[model samples]
Target chain A: MIKIAQLSCGTEYSSVQSEIEKAAFSVGGKMVYPDVGADDIDAAVKEFGFNPRSPQLKLMIARAVQLAKGVYDADAVFIATCFRCAEAALVRNELRRYIQEHTKLPVVTYSFTERMKSAQLLTRMEALVTIVSRKELLARERQTGLTAGLDSGSSTTKALVMKDNKIIGKAWMPSYDVVESATTVLNQALEQAGYKLKDLEAIGTTGYGRFTLGRHFDAKLVQEELTVNSKGAVWLADRQKGEATILDIGGMDNKAITVRDGVPDNFTMGGVCAGASGRFLEMTANRLKIDVTELGKLAEKGDWRNAKMNSYCSIFGIQDLVTSLGEGKAFEDVAAAACHSVAEQVYEQQLQEIDIRRPIIQVGGTSLISGLVKEVGSVLGEMPIVPPDSQYIGAVGGALLSSGFLM
Target chain B: MKKIFIDPPNSMILFDIVERLGHEPLSTMAALQERVDNLEIDMPPMNVTLDDVISGLKYAGIEVPSGIRGRLATWGPHIDEADAAIVMAEAPYSFGCVGCERSNEMVKYLLRRRGIPVLWVEYPGDKEAAMRMLEKTKEFLGGLE
Candidate 1:
């Protein structure tokens, strides 16, 4: 059995301790607490640079020191703490960084509450297992066989066909019912590529509708969007062999991920609300009486400073735009303001979660909007790479990873 | 007799019942009274000093938000001294909001982690639920030595 280190505080008292162990066990992992000598009690405080009243947290740091020193044998690490305790949160994040720097073991950090169940921890544990147990597959540089990938996103569905490391066919359309949307894009892409579903060696599904689509297609790989998107991003941006940060500003939310050598080490996703998303930009375009695509060109030409909008609420944001236009501001400037507002909100709310690396790759449908892309660059002070076919990222990511399952 | 820790420390139901059971109930109101009654400080507001808040670092980190630090400073040590605890979870906010969830979760975490006997019951929504809560409380307190 693969040994996965459980370095955490506060779970033993909470109802979720057994739940964590069960989740690990379900994924063929054994959760082991690294034992430390009683003598190391004070030494842990000195080494870890913090003293907590909880002996459990103190012992946790000592165990981390032991693991970093190679005194323990483990394939992966799961670092967790109670969501309520600020001290535990600090220790958990610091331990994650320390372990990642000291060892090559895959690490996943989580802050949980007393109400959390095992089901919530399962996918995280499964991802750690997948990263450790299938490193070779994830490390595979190029696709070698016929594989199909389906991405069922919030606002759109995408399907792609890949062969010999090259995308042969792809289709993007508005999302409808989960299975119907997936089937529609899958059929379109397959027909365009002149390949039948029977000809595919393996299939992978990802995005919001992954569970339903994976079941419908009997997919070989049903992976979360975090892993898939990172894989797809690095592959498309040619940053697979290096470290980079990924920014996918989606329709309903935003995701900021920091990756190392194409593997996602840290992932965070959320937005204040839909106000900081592409739907807001689309709404801005409608208010400006222009297509979403035209807003980009207009934004590039006009200055964002000329039109000011707050991304706190969509209604309030639109009102700002209307007021600006009533003040006789150009549509170009208003479009620029809309993109910049979304970018600023994303930078403020979402990007604060992860450490941004070089060559930040912006994917998802919004990445194609030149205005949003420029505004993101201005806000981040670093130009992001919008790789070719960026919109097909989820589909490509699913296809690329699932291709490994092909025999 | 055993000391019973009640959350919010202001719940009359918990305070009155635990007191009737012939045990000291560690309620915030009681603890605050003891602190404020001390004639050492000159301030009429009964406010704590900066030195007092930094002391909470033993319980939480310095990075913890200021408000939570203040709460933990006053309650953390008290929770440590608890032999047994009775927590009424999710008290309705409209009629009477018992305590902030963040405070409740933190206190419960500390109380439960000590391996102390804890009687966890939800705030009663009806007479039936109230009766059940009372029965559980009686059984739990009675079962304790």
Candidate 2:
């Protein structure tokens, strides 16, 4: 296993690092380094007169050199991480050096890019990694500290704890009272990680529920929703290949993220409407008497017919579903049709504005249904669909991010 | 001292301030053509771009009044050309209001990048804030002097 010797700056960083170390070591790894500070970054940047706006070519070259040096010195898996703000270019160069040092093992690095093109690249890499690194049995024992992530999404409050870049503990709950739900899931995740809340150094709050539940935690608030989701998607993908287009369907609205070149490039959102979202699926499921979880899988096996589901309105869609059912449509076919309808509508409105060249990653509670991905894939021909461990993507991403950040 | 251009017809205070500054109005025509002509001595032909809007006050083949063209031509170039800009904006109503707020930010970003000082007239419509706004504007202009 790749061991991460983690450190952060200030008391908060230390605390966060310690928590991660505890979680990481418990899962069979070694961690031996103090939390880092601005002084470390200062010393590194001063060597090259690193300007914040340095070109990507220069930054990548520098990161390769740094990653090599880091691996050689540490004798462990070295991953260099940075925030998306002014420090991104610098991190890029540093990551390269660390990677070179750990030639035997892969060195991971993440930069926050607001562009959809970059996000796609990162998504593919992480998804490939996840597929290869299946079945994380390290949770039975704890050796080094690990880090966990918390994603307070609009519809659900979820927490994921990780060690050695693998999932450890995960919990999800609908966001009713956001603070209470977040705390509950966070506590559950902490227990799973064999750590406590006091051990946490950094906590990231995201989604629309982020600002609303801001007062509850003493953690960092990632201002941009795109950054949070991009990081989350990358982590859940583990190390997958292919352009990642994350479709986050929530109760009140829906958000689409495109991760290209390991950074978020572009995003589009449906402005506050449950009609074109997971909530619509829920209502349809209730009326159809099929558990939402079984809907996708069942739809996958069933033969689908082209049933017209017009009227972008959810209320209208519900009436359409009812009338269509009254006309003797099969449950699996209708479910399949509804899935296709939503995907088609979304693509029509926003995806037309975007280049649908990459594979689409469907997330959120609605994504858990088995056949939805297949049906959506069939409707949007040639586009691959990557549906991860159900709807816990945000939570899993949160945990993986926490592991990286804390380390 | 460099000459600064003002836009639209006018207000009493804005006119008085410009007069008090002891600067000459470089005729609307000259101000509009200054940048391009300064590069080369060839003066582009003067044309009335806005005359077609004023119908009925025609002469022969010309459809609109050149006089009306002269009045509209007083403002040239976007606000981007200014070394500094002072926009009258109100709070709550105008703090994040679409056009005003966006324009204010864009102007500020442009001017600051150019190392120019900007004067902001917040709550311009409020009577109680008028004196305060004047004082701020004076101080800002004094810095330029």
Candidate 3:
């Protein structure tokens, strides 16, 4: 019997462990670390010569596992699914320590934020795949030859229609509604391909709005944004491998995934803050009464040698822009400089610590801006950046994943 | 003027009490640090510890050699200016939140240990109730006078 347990520490651990124990018992499995308590905490702290009140308590999870008696008939997996906070992280380490002190189990732990992203992706994929398979089972009976991918992003919605590994037709539109945005664009893409929705063999949905699309359509959704982008990017770049980092900058939010040896090991996202995203740039462009397209092109031609944006907050960054203008800096220079500043922040917070010794791929809506690519490249060094058809990697990946061409 | 200094990471109750005390209120260091990203500098953070709260009441200002009480205490002179000191309790019914409750208890304990007139202020959930409490406290202080 294989039993997996995700337990908490502090007072919350008792109830959670009880629930796990009951479930394991029903399944005819033995519990690991069955007698873990405050005594365990005291003995370990005493042996380790450390204060129990210190953050070291979090390391006890591993130690407790070491203290557990002999190997039982069941194989146990322990995952520390603690809440997100520095304190919680400290506590998580304590739990791991206890496990180490007691028994030896396959212990795996991830930060709360990373676990959340992984779970969110899993939730989306479950819904998307169910819908896609259902649509396909019906499509084979209907004798209709249509398949589509819908990307309902925060700023734009697009559909890619494909048949047998070839892009047959595509449709672009501004998206709305939880369901209709994905459905309408999908229908439009199928029509452009000269087929009906029922004609498509399978449809996959991907984007910031993928879950909403799942709610509306009977198609598969894949949430491995990194996997989706990597597949799409690898297809575009013809599977060349080295260290690779991909920056997918969308209108509202953006993510940077570091791909090593052709697989995504870790990634970082700027979801909680919009200031470090493409939307801030577009809004800034709008405020200046200039088309974002022109702003992008203008950025390619200017030099913001003196622009200084010291604020970590986007609101403050905007104020810094106004201050730059007041200092008699050219508007284009400030705008270009603003773009550079955001890229720098992304680099400092996300990329700087991670050694990306591979070719980097820049994708998504902001990838359309030649200046952004150029600026991001200047900071990232000379890495191979594969630009895909229509900078809509999310939707394209959804389509490709649905087709099973780039899973 | 009667002065009341409130420590940061305080008991929630004392936050309202010092505000009600009708004296100039200065928050302790940790409260200011928590708001560092959004901190506006109308005044720099005041450095004080449990012992300074008691000494401040006696000397009308903190004198450096007096030293701070409790763990992680630091010595600073300016803390003595306040006539009364308050510790803000973050927990409404209880004394403080998990990581913070320790410091809050320390300040309150040290002040009481030194026989300083330190008081625990409970948070009034509503604005009107808080104002009424303040008016009542002022009247009581006047009666004492």
Best model number under DockQ: 1
Q: Where does candidate 1 stray beyond 4 Å?
A: A1-41, A50-60, A78-92, A110-125, A310-330, B1-145
Higher-TM-score candidate of 1 and 2: 1
lDDT of 1 by residue, A1-407 (tens): 77889987655433356777888898788899888876775687688787765555677788888888899888888887765566766677777778877888877777665445666666567667777777787787687699989998888999999999999999988898999999988999999999999998988998879889999999999977777888888988988888999999999767788888888776666644788999999999998888887888889999999887875788888889889999999888899999999999998765754568898999999998999999999999989999999998889988899988877
| Tens digit per residue, CA lDDT, model 3, B3-73 | 55555434444455545555555443333344343444221123222232343334222221111121113
- Please tell me what DockQ candidate 3 reaches: 0.02
Model 3: per-residue Cα lDDT over A1-407, one tens digit each: 34434443321211123333444444344344433444454554455454433222423442444345442222343333333334445455555444444553433333322113233333222222222233332122111224567777778787888776566777666667747766677777777778877777767776667666755666764443545565555545544355567777767766665554344434545555667788778866876678777777777776757766656677888888888878988777877786787677677655642446566777777777776777787777664375666465655666666665223
Taking the tens digit of each residue's C-alpha lDDT, what string does model 2 give over A37-122?
A: 32343344455454332222233333333444453233333232222223442344344344433443323333211111222223
Which one wins by lDDT: 1 or 2? 1
Estimate the TM-score of every prediction.
0.69, 0.47, 0.55
Error of 2 at B34 (Å): 32
Candidate 1 - chain A - TM:
0.84
Rank candidates by DockQ, best first: 1, 3, 2
Question: Which residue pairs collide, candidate 1?
Answer: none
Worst 10 residues of 1 chain A by lDDT: A9-18
Interface RMSD of each: 16.0, 27.9, 17.0
True contacts kept of 3: 0.00
Interface RMSD score of candidate 3: 17.0
- TM-score (0 to 1) for chain B of model 3: 0.44
Computed on alpha carbons, the lDDT of every model, listed in order, comes to: 0.79, 0.49, 0.52
